[model samples]
Target chain A: MRYERPTTLKAAAQMLAKEKGQAFILAGGTDLLVRLRTGFIEPDLIVDIKSINGSKTIQKTATGFKIGSAVSGAELGEHAALKKAWPGVVEAANLIGSKQVQGRCTMTGNLCNASPAADSVPALVAAAAKVVIVGPKGKRTVAAEEIPVGPGKTSLKKGEIIESIVLPKRPPKSGDAYLRFIPRTEMDIAVVGVGVSLTLDGKGVVTKARVALGAVAPTVRLVPAAAKALIGTKMDKAALDALAAACSAACSPIDDKRGTRDFRIKVAGVLARRAAVIARKRAGGK
Target chain B: MSGITVNAKINGDPVEFICEADETLLDVLRNRLGLTGAKEGCSTGDCGACSVTVDGRLTCSCLVLGAEIEGHNIGTIEGMAHGEELHPLQKKFIEHAALQCGVCTPGFLIAAKSLLDKNPDPTETEIRFGLAGNLCRCTGYDKIVRAVQDTAKEMRKTNSRKGA
Candidate 1:
């Protein structure tokens, strides 16, 4: 195996394009290294992108923030301004693994790893983040929800890499939260994960909302109907019930050893409702 | 696929070595260099038994490629002590009987040190969460937490005296 560290993004892109599909882009290496040790993958080329310019920075835009694809979870947690703006996103990225793992893992890796149960995916989807993809063709942006097509699969074509994820500006009275049900306290994949981002009006009614669920579908499911249930409402029991029903209605979880199909479906609604409540509270709701 | 040369400072010593692309930092440090304080608990990042500080950042060495640690500073369990005196956390661990099996002790010490660097004084809950990555099955974490707390108090006293 050859390890290539390219200092420039153009050189990195050129190297990846040259290797065709046999090269794996090494981000934080929390996931890629394990696969290498276990012989799960045998790529001839390893393109290390940390040396690339601006690959590990958190740049603030006028609207919101652009987080580098190689930024570690610990780095994200230490950013006071970024944390204050996107606590749910930071907490979800922090939930990927243990403290040491957090020091080396990236949310981009979590998303690109393409695990249906990734803790950060649902949060990114709920936040309406856009991934900036760099390829041999050029640069283009896509919704985070559209990146993961299936389990262990991504829509990124050959020689394409995610440069950063752009989180749009949050309006006033906005808050977001992510919660997941895991059998163990730590070091466990999510049985069901839910993310809720909402904005409220002066009357404390939810003006806009986005609900996303994980581990209950092939890809992270964005439930528009669930969000629709909360709009213009004060998130009372009736509206929360509609939200839960919408979440349950959208689930298609497989019966895995960690959780059964029926159990995951039920927990999806419960988690979604609970997450919506937390998000509402954060958004200064009644 | 040839071996790549790595240049880094391990425990204040500038060291250079060649490692394979598939080689992990923990493996290189233990197998090649014969510094075996960081144990490979699971070979994956799940277990913090292989925790080390690369460039002052707490990380699992197993998750880092050996060649990728170029031009960085590494702190390991072996470098925790100076001369004949043990680090405060190291002494406190022994005094408090923090380890029963000793397999996870190095990792816990390294992790606690990492936490103290960030938070000079951590609450019990903070300590628990900070060291959540490093697991110890023997003492049930009571003694380990106490040891870290005691070390923190002692270190704070030393700092205050220096100020005075």
Candidate 2:
């Protein structure tokens, strides 16, 4: 095995583009290091990306925020402005692992790891997050959801490295929330996860909304039907019921020891309704 | 592969070491530096037996690569004591008997210390959430939780006295 900690994105990309053997990006290493130690993955090279400039800081945009790839969950939670702007995103990122893991796990790593149950992906999908990538070719932007093609897989080409995640600006009276069903109280993968983001008009009626579900598909699923169910109303029981049905209808979860497929299908709707309600409340609702 | 040189500040002291690319921080601290306080329980992040603080952030040392510690600050259970004087969390663990076989004590202490550093007067729920990563199979966690609670109370009282 070999290790290289390049201080520049171009250098890192050039090294990755030239590498012949299997290469892995090391950011936070909450997952990669464990994989390396357990023989789950034996990459010939490890590229430590934290040494790259601007990969570990959060930058404020004219509207939203651009968080670096190596920014740990602890750092995201500490950013009072980011938390205020995107509480659901921050909370979902913090929910990925334990405090120990939180201190080291990165949102970029979580999304790139592409776990079906990754706590960060659903919220990012709902927030309409975009990933900036640098490869041998050059820099480009891609939707966060487009990166995770399947479980433990990514669409990122060889020699491509994700630089950061850009959270788009939110309209006024907009809020988001993420909720996951875990059998354990903490540090467990989600059986079902839901993220809901919505905006309300001055009259307290839902005008725009996005609903996303995780652990129920190969990648996080953005259910437009679920969002439609919540739109054009005060988020009343009938609308919430429609949202739940849409969420349950959209699920394609696998049955395992953690949870049965039928149970996951049922809870998907439940969590979607609950998350939407929380989001509504956060958006200055009654 | 070849060994890589790593430079970092550990427990307020400058340290340098040569480690392989695949070596974990837990392996280096225990096998190389003889800081055997952080044990490899699960060798995964699930079990917090290898808990430490890298750059003042609590982390499972097993989950971090030794080669990545360049220009970082690390704190382990071995540094919880000042010469013969014990840190409050360590002293309180002894006072409360928060251990059975003692394999998980270092992790619990480091995790609790991390919590106390961030929030000196954390609620019981916060304490539980903070230490949830560190699992203790023995003693049912009641004793460990009580030890952390006592340590927090003492630390708060000490801080208030200093302020006064």
Candidate 3:
């Protein structure tokens, strides 16, 4: 295997494009190394992007935040401003793995790994996060949910690299929260995960909302019907019931060792309601 | 094929070695540099038995490539002691009998030290969560928790005395 650390994103993309054999991008290596050790994947070329300029930074852009693809969860947790601006996204990123894993894992890696049960995807989708992709043809931006197509797959074309994920600026009285149901307290994959983000007017009515669910579909789903249930309502029991029903109706999960399809569908609605409650509270609602 | 030469600082000592692109840092530490304190309980990152610090960040050495450590600083369980004097956590672990078969002891010690380094006086829950990555199958973890708590108190007392 050939290992190359490129100091520029263009060079890294070039390396990946020029490689005749299989190539893999080494971000945190929490996932890549595990696959490598288990003989799950044997790539002919490994491109390490940590040396790429601005790949390890969390910058405050005029619109929102630009988190580098190489930034670790620990670094995100330490960024006081980013944490405050998008607590749910930060918390979801921090939930990816154990403290040891958190030291090296990146949100971009988690998203690109494209695990339907990935802890960070639902939250990023609900937050309307966009990734800046750089490839042989140049740069393009896409919604976070557009990246994952299926289990362990991504929409990123060959030689296309995600440089950074941009989060939109949060308006006043806007809050987001992510919740997942796991058999254990930690180190287990999510059976069902939910993320809810909403903005409230002065009268405590939801004006804008987005609801996302994970591990219950081929890709992390952004449920407009569920979000519509919350919009224009005070998140009362009636509106919450509608929200729960919508989330349950959207599930097309499969029966796996972690959970049954019916159980995951049931938990999806439950987690969505609970997440909406927490998000409402964070937005300064009673 | 010729291996890649890597220059790194392991436990405050500058060292250089040649490793394959696919060689994990855990292998390089044990095979090439002869630092076997970090055990390989699971080759995967699930088990923290290979716990070490890369640039002072607690990490599973098995998950990191040796070639990636070219300019990084590494802290291992071997660095936990100062000469003949054992670190307080080590002394407390011995007093509390925190080990059974001794395989996971090195990982636990490194993890506890890292927790204390970040939060000098971690609550029981904090200590439990901080060291959650390191799994000890032989010991039930009560004694290990107590050892870390006792060490924290003793270290805090020493720090206060030095301040005075």
DockQ, in order, for the candidates? 0.84, 0.90, 0.85
Q: Which pairs in model 2 have colliding backbones? A: none
DockQ-based class of model 1: high
lDDT of 2 by residue, A143-238 (tens): 999999999999999889999999999999999999999999997999999999999999899999999999998889999999999899999999
Residue clash pairs of candidate 3: none
The lDDT-based order of candidates, best leading, equals 3, 2, 1
Q: How well is candidate 2 docked (DockQ)?
A: 0.90
How much lDDT does each candidate structure score?
0.92, 0.93, 0.95
> In lDDT terms, which candidate is top?
3
Clashes of 3: 0
In candidate 3, how many Å is residue A235 off? 0.9
Q: What are the TM-scores, per candidate, against the unseen true structure? A: 0.98, 0.99, 0.99
In terms of DockQ, the best-performing candidate is 2
Indicate whether candidate 2 or candidate 3 has the larger lDDT: 3
Model 1 ranges with Cα > 4 A deviation: none
Q: Write model 2 residue lDDT over B1-164, tens digit each, in one string.
A: 57899999889799999999899999999998999999998988998999999988999999999888889999999888999999999899999999999999999999999999999998889999999999999998999989999999999999999999
